[model samples]
Target chain A: MYDGIVQDLIDELGRLPGVGPKSAQRIAFHIIQTESFDVDRLATILQTVRERVRFCIICGNIGEEERCAICRDPRRVPTAICVVEEAKDVVAIERTREYRGLYHVLGGALNPMQGIGPDQLRVAQLMTRLQDPTVEEVIIATDPNVEGEATATYLIRSLLPLGVRVSRLASGLPVGGDLEFADEMTLGRAFEGRRTVER
Target chain B: MYDGIVQDLIDELGRLPGVGPKSAQRIAFHIIQTESFDVDRLATILQTVRERVRFCIICGNIGEEERCAICRDPRRVPTAICVVEEAKDVVAIERTREYRGLYHVLGGALNPMQGIGPDQLRVAQLMTRLQDPTVEEVIIATDPNVEGEATATYLIRSLLPLGVRVSRLASGLPVGGDLEFADEMTLGRAFEGRRTVER
Candidate 1:
């Protein structure tokens, strides 16, 4: 047990994903020991983000305005839209600098056990966006896990009838990882997606 | 790279102690996805703590007013004071429900490499507190590691001249711990601190 304020902080931190009770305690204690200015800055930013930031009306990505930057950028390819499970996935894909298209954040993947389904996601809005005459392709960039795979499959089936070219990101062994340590599914995918080497 | 605001949030989270860039990224994403009400609650509490909490002038623990609850409580023995390095240490000691004395938070332990000396600590304030006529005993509850041990030794040397009784927390094997698995120092401490059982 800890002091009331410290316990409150730990409880709030523990509610975060991947943060256990021990981690929450450690962080709470660290915050208590840190300078008040630093803690105030963090608190200010936390409040500012919640107050000034919101999901883009066009795509579910976070932004200060109604639409995300990519959605407003004329240079980005409006013909193709990459769909992801969360706003973070959009950032992850952007880091590659390979896509020149817009994004549609589904908020979360379909997890029946968690009671999250297609109705709970922004799938209907995505369908509405696909109705634009300029749109041609939809890239499903959901995570390669079971839930992600299920969501992608469901989206592909639904998008096929709309006459849009639907695709999923390839799955394989990670770069810089040893082939010997690769799991069977990843190694198999790497073999299946093998490309010809240029001399 | 993420949106500027998202990046700012990640950077702020990364500044927290023990939170690496990867962990910060994870936490930032988790925060973004969390329910708006939960995020708002965290923001509110963070602001409340920063605005309302202040250090107790007497014991240095966080509180709303001049003195912390522990220091203000008349039930606690004001005649004895336990010295510790940080406010978190005071909370840790209180959880045991063993000692019933007031506390003196020294802010940090003595570390020569880091250039932290007695001058940087609250040792002077502790001595001032000891000058009170009713004070009879001082408990050196600094940590057991190198810096803590050094601090305890320093406190013992400094406090002995004041004619006040000084005691260190007993060192021994932890309750419910295996004797064979205990480290040599712990096992030796347990043997040295062996007590007669009332059979």
Candidate 2:
């Protein structure tokens, strides 16, 4: 489709999660045509990210330091650890400003079809973290999908014997969403989790 | 939304064409999480593309050397020169395998709203290329939209005096496209350019 190095650039760019071939070509051309585009800077950052970024030792979250920002922050409540499937989920929770507790990233949810079992996840590290006497509750904030639910179920069974309180994130229709558009499963969940309004 | 360098990487990726903030974050996280992902390779290619690729001196098409592949290829018909709006457009036409002529990249279309006119394009270079005694035809393959039509119109006016056979890529409903969904302008063009059966 394109010359040697140009085609190579497009192929490499297309390897990213969502970027397809057309997008890769468009991006490659943009980098080539836009004189003001900082190609060196982008390249340098990519190299730096690869070199400097690493998973936190305590939690599976990504950061430059040994421990993630949430784990390092003294103000975050250590008693309640919110467990999520990935580091990106931690960022999503952080944006809400609702949860002021620590996080434990599982790296990924369990998917038996992909051969990703409990051992493949950071479950062992999470269990080890729960041994601390001060930590009281574990919040299973994994995604509401099938794999996430299975992972949450496994974690709940494992943590119940340890005498720690376990809770899963509620699933229901999203706020400000049209009820008519809500799928049957979600509508059912919303009905089951209905709470009385306080005046 | 993310930590220092991670956020910076996301911002840089978001600057690319068609990449939004969420997609940038997803790509950044993929790079961070997947150790097998060739970050260094991608970075090196980015640097190489910026350092090596330059527009062809003969026509404005992009290449690693002074002349583009088409311009250097002796097998191509030297008598016909196809004029295109961008280097990408040249690739599109090449894939069709219908044209074997040389190419002259205009870099962009004539858009008065954006302050782009004949001066901003490679019009002079095209005119100079037309002066070759062996060149017999000049095909305008600019896009079908407004700016492309304006550029084709401008080129037609400029090339008519030089006695070169000036022509334009036909406008009409695309092949295999739904005629019912075709716009009025396209339908009009199709009617105006209707060819007679040669039986």
Candidate 3:
């Protein structure tokens, strides 16, 4: 519905994860009309990211080098590895300032419908890392969805024989969230995973 | 929360319209991981759009040349012109295929909160265009929101003494919208502008 290059820019932007047609148009217009928007800088960054960024050879996290920053840092605990669905999940976990261990990015979770399975993920790489015998625990931190749960189950099954402790991130009501708004599955999980308090 | 270039890319993407930090991260990751996404093409288009596209000098609509396609067309009625707030609105009106006239883009609406006034818009250029004896009518098709309404009102006051027909697009119930779900203002407008139907 727009002229040549404007429409082309919108079409490319619309292919991103959450951008719709209207949003694409708005962004494209902002780029075209706003003089201080730094079109060259954004375009340069896009080109640079494509040329520079790559997955860490060890954990599959995004980085420029063979290993990501966390994997390269010797201060982090190598004994405990937090396994997650993607590199984004690693960042989410890192934001909490709780986990001091390294990470393993699975690339994606198991989805039978989409034909994604054990072979599609970095499951073999994870297993190879566990062969060191120094790693004591593997914490599965995939999303609390069907595909994530299936992936966790599959990982648990595969890691059991290696004798390392396997654990999953707890499922329950979110912090500061009202119980009334909690879904049935979450409420049920909260009840099932209930812990006793000291008197 | 991320490394150098990756974080830089995310920060840039986050500055776009409707994209928050999380969405920016997702888009950045999509660019980094998806080999088939064609990052070079998107980046190249961004650069090309900035280098090539410019607004039509006559009507203030975006195009590659001195005047936009609509302004250059000879078949469209020269007597009637649709005055809209932006180039995007011209596309919206054209999609309906209901109007067969030229367009005059005002750049933006009269937004007092944002310090936008008549001088900030293309009001003077519109007046200059209307000076031609051949022009007979002006249709104000700005948005239906507060700023758009204010702009329409301002345009009406300015264009009244021009000795040409001036009209605002009808405000009422949307075509496929339910009357019960209509907002109070819209319902009131519907009643105020009610038209008699012939059986």
Candidate 4:
């Protein structure tokens, strides 16, 4: 029911993971109401990023250059690499401010039902990278979901023969959530990873 | 923790109404993953709409030219006009096959707390439009909220002396809503609007 350009915008917005038709319409109206200069700047940045940004050859993170900033940073621990399923995960981990290691994006997690296998990921590339004597530890930071766990299991099995230290992110009850409201998996993990109180 | 361009994109996306920082980050990542051609097209359209779209002088609806499509259409009934709070409301009414009348978008509803008054709206323009002898009826289709009710009341009072028929959209139980679970206001409306059944 919208004009041609507006409809195109709504259609494109609806293609996003969580945005629905109503939300697409709302966003389109918002964009239409915004000032020309502001909208134009957004458009310019979108186009610019599309033209300049590409996956980092070393770690698969998004970057305008051949190497991502994390890959090139000299202060980052070269001996330790954190493996994740996607580039977005790298950003998530970076926000925590705890990890100073490098990253290796696997492109996607293994899902045999959807035909995504080990070959589809950068597993071989990761194995080759680990062959370097400077690399010491590999931390698997995939999502705590089924596909993520399966991918981590596959990685651990493949990497064990290489003699590198392998680790996975600890699972437990999230802080601030009520125990009664916690899901079975989380509660089970909390039980498994329980710690003794020293104080 | 993100690169400067990615942060810029996230900030810009966050400026849109209803889009939080987390949603903005997700949208930015989705945009980054999209093909260059698709991203360029969306960016180009955003710029094009910003540069070309303008408010119709007579009706206040968005248009590329001086007048909106509805204002230019000769077949629409000139004797009756549907007044709404926003341009999106006009689109919503047009989707139904019911109304063949013209439209008058009021920019926004009356709200004293928000500093919006009749002067802030297109009430003066609406009055001018009604001055034409061809106009006979004005349908107030504002939202079913406090601000909309106040605007409708104000319009009815103003238009009574002009010798034009004024009507408000009926408020009652929604089509898909359960009568037993409906709120007091909606249930009260349903009772007030009760009609004799033809048994």
Candidate 5:
């Protein structure tokens, strides 16, 4: 800590996720020294994000209004709703330019260790969104981790009786990634999900 | 990119040093999602720092007033001033609990290729500070880089005629760092700076 405001800035920066003390120090100095960096714009955006941005009423995804862009998009298929653990996941899926369905953000996956359960999530909201008769399939696009798997399993069990086709995003070897470097579980999953190539 | 404010926040965060697009997204989300995170306070601090913080009139270190905390503190040896390239360097030296002297921040090292020279730095301010009869010794704690070495050489040439004793920070193997993996230059410096054990 150097002085009053400097130390305070470092402390605040350090509180951000993945920003350790050393990183916080570097960032604080960066903000101070980088003459071209617009600190005012960043602060304003932060304030605006807090004030204007909110969860979509229908799907729990982040939005400026009651409905998110995907929810409001007429081009998206209403018959399919992709369920994800967070709003960021929605962005990741969108980046692929493949999925053209509405999204249902669960807010977070079920993590029993962290005292986060289905009740703690937007699971109720997801269920409510599925009640629409136009929905045909629910794609589980949660992370390939224990908590995400548990959440997907719970949702699958719950959605089976709802008379909807439930599906999940496939986990396999990523493109351009080394096959030998892949973990045992990913390799096993790849083998399990093997499909016949069309001639 | 995310919807509206989310994307805006991510963009703003990405402008920060060392924060890549992914890290920016993560930080932006963290700021929006964290329940206890005081966005208001962080914003206030950034604004306050920008408003209140200023370079010291004398030494060019960051200060709320005309003088920095170290400069204001009478306990520090006024006769011995440590020279560094940036305000961050002052904090780094302060952290060691070794140096209890005033500091002169040069703003940046002499980078001739990049067009930074003696005139661009706080060279005149440093020379003025050294003119004080009470001031005896000047310690150069600039980074051990080409630019820093050039700046040090320039300072030494300039200060020698003034009859003030000038010293430089020692270059050697870092404490607790593996010697086997140490670069040749570092190993050579370590050998050159080898100190005899007191009997």
Candidate 6:
């Protein structure tokens, strides 16, 4: 809808993960109109990230070095490893400040319908990490959806023979949410997992 | 929420026009995971756009040359110039294939509340363009909102002295839209601008 170079810019912006056509147009125009916007700096950052960033060899999480920050940190618990579906999941868990263990990104969960199975994920790397006798437990923090549950179940089966404790993250009504608006599955989980209140 | 370089990438992405924190995180993860996505090409396009592209000297639209594609096209009707609020509006009108003429981007609408006045836009350039005796008409295609209306009114007043025919794009119920769902202002305009049917 524009000259070659302008159209090229829009097309490249549209190729990003979530930018739709209208949004891409808006952003392209924004870049064109805003005189103070430093497009060259953004370009340099993109180039640098592509050139320097790499996945951690120990886990699948992103890092500029050989291993992820959590994996390199001495304070992170070596005995406990939380398995998550993506690197973004590691960020989300980190925001909670509750967990102090290392992470292993599975890239994605097992979705047989989508042709993603245990072999497609970083499951083998996880199993190898578990080979150490010092590691006492593996926490499956995959999503509560069908694919995530399937992946967690498969991991449990694989880890049973290794004699390490395996646990799944809890699924229930979210905090600050009312019971009336909770979905059926969440309401049921809330009931099944109810704990005694201490006075 | 991530390692140093990954966090820096997210921060830069978040500074873009419409990307929020959550969207920034999502795009960062997508860039990291999709090995096939050509980040280098995107970076190159961005750099090229910054270094090579500039606004058309004649119309204020983005262009690789001194004049935009429309301004350079020999076949475009020179007499009819479509006045729009931004470069994005040029793209929207071009998609319709209805306006076969030149364009004059005002850069922004008049919003006195925000301290934007005629001097802020390319209004002076628009008036200077009308000095050419061959130009016969100026079509005001600014937005339908209050700020757009104010800008159009100001342009109409400014162009009256030049004796060139000043027109406005019709505003009413949109094509394929239900009359019942039309807003009161649009429904009122639709009745006010009712045209006689030809037999």
Q: What fnat does each of the candidate structures reach? A: 0.47, 0.82, 0.86, 0.61, 0.74, 0.72
lDDT of 4 by residue, B8-121 (tens): 888888887778877887788888876643877778878777767778898898777898888888999998888888887777666544577888989888999999999999
lDDT of 3: 0.81
Better of 5 and 6 by lDDT: 5
- In model 4, pairs of residues that clash are none
Q: lDDT per residue, candidate 2, A67-184, as tens digits? A: 9888899999989888888898777667656677788999888999999999999999999999998888787777766787788789988988888877665556454432223454
**lDDT (Cα, 0-100) at B113 in candidate 3:** 86
How accurately is candidate 5 docked according to DockQ? 0.68
Provide per-model DockQ scores: 0.42, 0.75, 0.76, 0.57, 0.68, 0.65
lDDT of model 3 at residue B121? 93
lDDT of each: 0.74, 0.81, 0.81, 0.76, 0.78, 0.77
* Per-candidate clash tally: 0, 0, 0, 0, 0, 0
**Candidate 2 falls in which docking quality class?**
medium
Q: Is candidate 3 or candidate 5 better by TM-score?
A: 3
Model 3, position B104: C-alpha lDDT score: 95
Per-model TM-score on C-alpha atoms: 0.79, 0.88, 0.88, 0.85, 0.86, 0.86
Interface Cα RMSD for all candidates?
2.3, 0.8, 0.7, 1.5, 1.0, 1.2
Interface RMSD measured for model 1: 2.3
Candidate 6 backbone collisions, by pair: none
* Per-model root-mean-square deviation over C-alphas: 6.7, 6.2, 6.3, 6.6, 6.2, 6.3
lDDT of 4 by residue, A1-199 (tens): 7666777878887876568887787788788875543877888888777777789999988887899999999999999898888887787666555678899999888999999999999998899899898998787777666787789889988987878887766566454432323454654454344332211
Candidate 1 local lDDT, A1-199, one digit each (tens): 5546667888998887678876786677677665653766676677677777789999988888888887888999889888888886676566555678899999888999999999999999999998897898787767666787788788888888887777665556464432223454554454345332211
Per-residue accuracy of model 6 over B134-194 as CA lDDT, tens digit each: 8998877777677887887898888877888877766664754323234546644643453
On a 0 to 1 DockQ scale, where is model 2? Answer: 0.75
Which residue pairs clash in candidate 3?
A: none
Where model 5 places Cα greater than 4 Å from the true spot, the runs are: A173-199, B173-199
- Evaluated against the true structure, the overall lDDT of model 4 is 0.76
